[model samples]
Target: MKEAENRACEVMLHAGLLPQLATMETIAAAAGPVLEPFVQYLLRHISTPRGVDGVSPFELNAALANALIEGEEALTGLVSLAVSIVPLAPAAATTNSSSLTAATSGGVCSVSSLTRVRLTLHPAYPLNLIATDSFLNLHTMLWTLSLQLQWVAQSLIAARVCLWKESQSQKRSGTDNNTTFSTTTAPSTRAVQQEMLHLVHAVRQHMLTHVENTSVRMRRGIATCGSLREMQKQCGEYEEELRHGCLLHDTSSSQLGSRKWHNHNDGPAASASGSPELHSSLLEVLESSLRHCILLGHARQAKILINKAKQAQLEAEDAEQEALALDSLEFAKQKFSQITCAVAATEREFEGHRVAFMERVSVYGSEAGAHSDAARALLAAVDIQGRWQPQKGT
Candidate 1:
């Protein structure tokens, strides 16, 4: 077992995936105490120098940097998948008390425990020997992935909490009738909504930070283009017009200033006219940025809906508990109206973003057919909002 573990560590080190291996160790630690030894072994392996004799430190570091980048891409894909599937799972399940208890308690403990471990163990990769720009990019990706994982973990926790509460409610009610189940489920729904609101707020903050970092990197890339060679390197191609303009300048100093000024004026235009791969990549980044913004908006809307639903549930419960003069039917009508208003408001907000998202895709779609198709597919996968129905007795 020790030999196998060492061999695995050796492969990870040679592939420049020590950081990723560390991350996996952190994730695996969630499975329980059984994996503690494995995690410790990984920690020791990475910290100890097991040199690849022929490879220079610079080369190894470069490979590690590339691995960081690739891992980021993989994490982004996972986040996209998680977001797409978030609403597909039923928020609450109706089952026998025994089955529900077994499912919720057992499942929640294992999944949430593991995910929580990952959330806690995400480390700040050391930057002592790394280039500033590369480190910044690497850190941004790491932060984004960490946040995405946190969101997924929190979502799972919320589901688990809701399920556990439902199981408890089922046991308390001790009846299989629909009316009893619905009545008992109301409080749990409110509880779940509360947890979801907190999770969504955290996710929105992280997403905003991610978007800011990405924008800063994009701006930096555009601002640093200073010559034909630099422009070609950055933008991936130079037009004949730009090449001729470069030749027209008299002195090296003037040419340098001219190139900077010209690039500043025409950076977007140059990117538009650059190689297809370069243009597509830029568009993909923009699309991803916009998608994150849309996600933030969606999260905010979800919180609002949950708040409204909770408020309605509370009002209904209060009306029942108090033998007030106010008619229950009238109170129910008022609460339902408030929920409808909230839903309408959410729909309006989502529609605005949907329009903006579609406009972006349409503008870029003509330029990059394949990317636009993929973007459209992603857009299709996003749920505007689930259909709202008033719970019985509310």
Candidate 2:
């Protein structure tokens, strides 16, 4: 009997069940009388032989099945609780512990933690094999959980970029409508751009850390789980996908250049018109900002910014045209004033010459009257002729 008990303990230890059973014993002891019935039941089952007198084989099998179900439930609950607590744990924990915490908090899980968990569960292989359907279901659940966690981490980073872009856009909109020029907006815009660049860089760091950890885990899994060919392949594919997805290949600069070129050529007449050139340059800056937003995965905010920029460009063009028209009108008024002054000066000079000609004719008439009738008649004829004749220039 003693030999049989020793053998059972050895099997339980090998299966990694001894620690869990020991933990339960400790809890039961702490609870004292409250868990007495449960403790007694477990002890009785452990001590009882499979072929005891009146116990039917079928009944014995049923009890063992019940115990297995209960044990599975307990393990599942414990794992869930641990996962829930990890995010709230202090950051100074061991590397595996800290990584596990980060994973629960929507950050990458460490390769070491993943490997440890995988190896620790190896003792349950015999039980899992005995219940193939259940094992498959559990595997699927674990796979789904890991994928979901990874997605959550990615989404969290994307969300931060979106929020930052939106806030910067709001600040821009709050400025005076006439200040769309870079001279007015450049300093603030540059500050926001720098912030965004830093954020993207941080995201890249996180992604690299996650990818490296996943690669390490994959190598270890491949080395140890030789029979799990399909699983290893799937893991490899997932890791590759993550590496590609998380890589921050910045195409914003190129995209901005292309977009600016397109916008500059969008309207030849407008671009050629010097008055509206300011608006075109402003549009280029706005389009560049929009492209940056799009690259960072802030589609909704980018859309809003695009619409605002378009409206601002149109308004700027109108203002520039109005200014040009006002200048032309002022120039015309100045020319009209100069022409009027020159005409008044010519009229004054002609009036002065007419008065002098009248004075000379009166003097000649007085001198001719003193000479004779013939001379007077001659003088009167000359006066008539002078009055009838056209002026020298005419």
Candidate 3:
């Protein structure tokens, strides 16, 4: 009886239960009143000369101990057998002081040495196996879904690029098609821009899912079930995981945008971006900030972009409007010939405003150094998060 109770206590202790809670004295005291009778009956049966192919108590106990201590696979099978027999062993189940819950006809058996060991050996392993199996079965379907979504994002980007280029080309061609386009073209263009914006938003949103999942798993991996030292070790690994992933992500994204710019806009094809030095420096700073944000797990310079861009856009709009008003006035100056001096001064002022407006647009467009920097920052955020995958097994 003491041996059986001791074995049960050991199983509980290994399963992360407090040792004091499953102490030998407590278990023995708890099982004494009811367990003594079952033990006596079993002993009497085994001792009988005509015992049904009986095994000796010493032999049986030795075999059981050996199996429980060394034969993990066999022990697990025994535990399953015990759980299965719980319905027929109501009294035996009730007398046991262990904590494993196995449902049975009479009630529930709460003694499972096997389950405890399996859980102790590798808690994450079982969970990983289950998740991986599920993922495998559905991976093909998920890939199809991902491809469709990627197609949408790519299509929207391509369309926006095409339309923007076409608009610039038309302006360069001295086309006066604005009058013909007044009916539906403006609305259609707006719709396309809106769709493109929606697609960008969707892509960004989907990227967040991967980041969130990675965060959750990292937290879980760092969670401690043992002592403080173990916890610290787990936490250190988690931090390393975060730092490495962030740095790699930031660097990779920066390089991706740099390569794209080199291929499309930077190579001698009009040198869209002005001030190469400023552009390169800005990109470096932005990329650094993005890396900092990823490692620290928070946005660092997102506000800087917001504040700067807002101011720049406002100034650009005001300048653009002033220039347009001056142009209109200059066009209608024949009737007001007396205001020729005013018109000339206004034209000079408009030219100044035009330069300022161009500077701002160039800054915002692929032509300005700031554009390259901002593009690197934003794309780094998007691209890094996009390619991120939170997998198990480190």
Candidate 4:
């Protein structure tokens, strides 16, 4: 919901519309005119999990979906949250004894409860597997979720660029009605972008941690379960099994049911991503972010062109209006003479315009220099991300 709202906000920005109230309902109303008080009344009492924490709603959804794949419930492709509990660790038990006693007796406010982990279980995995399979599998899908979201972002931004360019072309050719556009970037635009990027990187850090942890867990599981006599090629196959909710097998000349799951720590991605288990999750995230930024830059360029061309159209219209006042042949001949004289004015001003543009670029470096640098950095990163993938198989 947050991601979708942000994209809608950007589209509204592109269309010279500002989000009023800056609520989800305000920003996401780019699709059409929003019905007023009725819509407000309906959404007034609505709330979503972690909605106030600025956490991407995708995180919870993805976490839940990943949790589903670990057991029998996955066969039905259905799962729901089970009973939740707060288990006090031994260390906290003594410190919170009085509060624990009060809570056990009074059924309220336990100091120990606040300090302990809130255990949320799904039917797919039991509490026993929390330290083993469930923990490892829980956060792995975050990487996939981020990449897919970023891919969608890139597509939307690219679409904006195409639409803007096409509109500009039609306007310039006098084939469409012209609308005024602003070249100025919004003050809050960078804030929104940075906020989104921060959430993304937060997700990426979790992805990295889970990938490494899961690879270790997979290795231990493999060693204990006796999946095969040999250790080679287990990680890749195991990750595949995890993905498909299938039995772990020895892909190397035989099959063994010794282990229920396997790890692809040895798969071809990189040590950076821990295993093929990660599918180069970190790299994919970085690439997706970079791609999104590049597409945004393309859209911005198209927007700039749209705004700057308005000057030429205005000038042509003013010239045509002046020419329309020529009621006499004498007046017309004099106007024609003036037009002939001004024919070379554009050629003469070309160098001046180039110099002025260069000056503006220099000023841009000092003014919005941070934004420009960030954009260039993103583009450079995109280049790197694009360079590596083709050399190896995903």
Candidate 5:
């Protein structure tokens, strides 16, 4: 039963059914009853390596960084099949009528246990499904992260290609036929610029798609928690507030600047209180606000990306650990097979042995034969080897 529960837990974690423990307290709260000693171990490991001040930006970033790193490792461990504990079915009372049914069920159970754990990449929730809001939010964050990575990769590729082309162009221009193709440079520059623009445009489209998908996933997560509606209300209110503030600031700046421009025609524009000066101030304020908005958007997006990368890293680590475990299991099986073969060989060599020897040979071929074979082989080689020669002389 314990083994079965552990297998179920592993399956849940790998399937992402188990929510990530974001805090040590949360981890304890969720898993303490089920895994007391393990939870305690986790708590000890999770204790603050260094104190962090919540109000300090540096400390907050550092804490988040550490959480993400550890979270990634944990996620990876979960994903790999190495974490699975295949639960054995209990033996049933056998009767002639049930025998065939039991046999079939046993086969089915074996097949099921052998099935690999698969990850289901869910789509973002529908815009209407408030039920999945949290999942949608998480999905959105991952999508944003993927987009950022893709954008960076594309930018690097584009830059390298552009540089290579420029170098080639310079080399060609320096050659004998240079003047003949000089006119091509203008068109080439235009083409290169267009390509770069296209790449940027494509990246933006990809990001938009990712956002939509993530939004769906977040909605699903929210729905699972029965908080989708609440999340939707909060998000709507937040968006409304952001839009209202932005519009109001924009309007105020435009109004103030226009008035100052009109007033400047009548007075000396250069004076501190004049329209020209006030206009400059107004423009600065507008620009500053816009910059602030942009920064906020960027920060939000960056946070999402970080979260997504952390998830991906976790999945990767799980895969690695699972592979290692499978390798270990295979290694053990091979060692067992080698021992079995050796035991069989030794038994064949002593086919005419007495009851004790026959028992030893039987043990070497039994389910737990590896150790028995080693023991028997050691004893026979050491104590019984010379004595057996007398039988041959007789």
Candidate 6:
């Protein structure tokens, strides 16, 4: 905007149009055609960093950074957990005398290894445009963004023209009424001019700030731009991502060793004590009770036999609980795979918007300013009607 404004000022000065003769109509007509390119430049500087239409994955997916950090911690926890727990099998004691597993209160634990490992991505939200990365979807978004920004720029240009018109109106009326838009109505003219200038600066600054922020995954330390507060947030999230970063990753991973093949275990009810061998166990208890009941008529030892069976049942339950923990890990692995694809698709769409933005910024920046000298000259000849503004040399 500054660049274009400077160039337009130069064109008017060089044309030698009588300054007093330059009416609002003449100025508008002179600048109209030349200002179109500047409008585009300003819009790109304003809207590109916000997202193609203000929905950016980088902005949307801050949870991915936390997920990444805690995820490593969770993984570290899992490893420590496995090492601490997985060796209570009675077979482990017999198989390796050198094993250092803690003694189980239950005679044995059925879970004997790290049966699974799973990952989970964070902040799983449901979305409407699930297939947002498709080329059709991406391009349509860019088209919408272009139209929105263009409308804003056009409205601003129209406002500048109206301000100029109102300035001319004041000169004609010679009313010290101190009006703004018309001879009768009023607003702060200086405020309007100052705001317009500040607005252009804001557009350029907004674009640059976000451009740096979006690179959180790539840059490090002071290279990534953000406020002091954001830098603090970046410390943990940023460090973990860099530590885990592998640039060339293969997305076609078939599995994560999350489940044991053909090892389907029965439910807790059956595993703990619901077997039809239940009949034999019950029969044994009944016989022992009968034999002791007679002695209880004379005080027999039936309670001791029943207590032994109860102890065995408690051990089976402990084993069942450990197996469920391993199963939970496997489920986590499944969730990770599903969410990874979704995240990738989103990031790809974000890249598309950025690329579209950069292509435009590059093209506009290639030229120093709008080429409007010819247009201004034509309008001057028509409006000023041969009244030559005196040249410095003349």
Candidate number of the best lDDT: 2
Model 2 RMSD, rounded to 1 decimal: 42.6
Regions of candidate 5 where Cα sits further than 4 Å from its true position: 1-73, 77-173, 177-183, 186-202, 205-224, 227-394
Query: Tens-digit lDDT track for model 2 on 1-394?
Result: 6566456434533554333322222231212342233323322332222101223334433443454345523443221111111121244345434563332221222111211111012224322322233322233223222322232233334545654665676577763323221244334434445433333233334333444444455444433332333333634454333322232111221221222323322332211112122222322333232223322332343344444554555555577765655555444444334332332332233233223322322332233222222222322332333442212110
The sequence of per-residue lDDT tens digits that candidate 1 reaches over residues 17-136 is: 333323332232222233333333222222212211222334433433344344433421111111000111233222322363332122221111121121112223221111133323
TM-score of each: 0.27, 0.21, 0.23, 0.26, 0.21, 0.20
Superposition error at 52 for model 5 (Å): 47
| Residue 60 local lDDT, model 4 | 39
lDDT of every predicted structure (CA atoms): 0.31, 0.32, 0.31, 0.30, 0.31, 0.27
Deviation from native of the Cα of residue 377 in model 1, angstroms? 6.8
Worst 10 residues of 4 by lDDT: 252-261
Identify the runs in model 3 with alpha carbons over 4 angstroms from their true place: 1-128, 138-142, 176-187, 203-207, 214-394
Least accurate 10 contiguous residues by lDDT in model 6:
245-254
Off by over 4 Å in 1: 1-128, 131-142, 145-333, 368-394
Candidate 6 lDDT tens digits, 1-394: 6566455434433332122111111111112232333334333432222212232234323432343244422222111111011222466456444443211101121111111111121111111111122312222222222223233334345444555664676688763331122332223332432333233233323322322332333234323323333333543343222111110011111111111211111111111112112112212222222211121111112222323334444455677754554454344333333332332332333233222222222222232322122212222322223433212110
Q: Which residue pairs of candidate 4 clash?
A: 235-263, 235-264, 236-264
Candidate 3 local lDDT, 1-394, one digit each (tens): 6566455434533553332211211111211332233333333343222222243445544443443455323333212111011022456436532433211100111011101111011113112222232222122222222322333343345545554554566567653342112234534543534433453344334333432444455445433234333434543443333222212121222222243221122222212222232223323322222221121111112222333444455555577765654454443332223222332332333233222222322333243332344333333343333432211110
Tens digits of per-residue lDDT, candidate 4, 309-341, equal 443445555666434432332343343333323
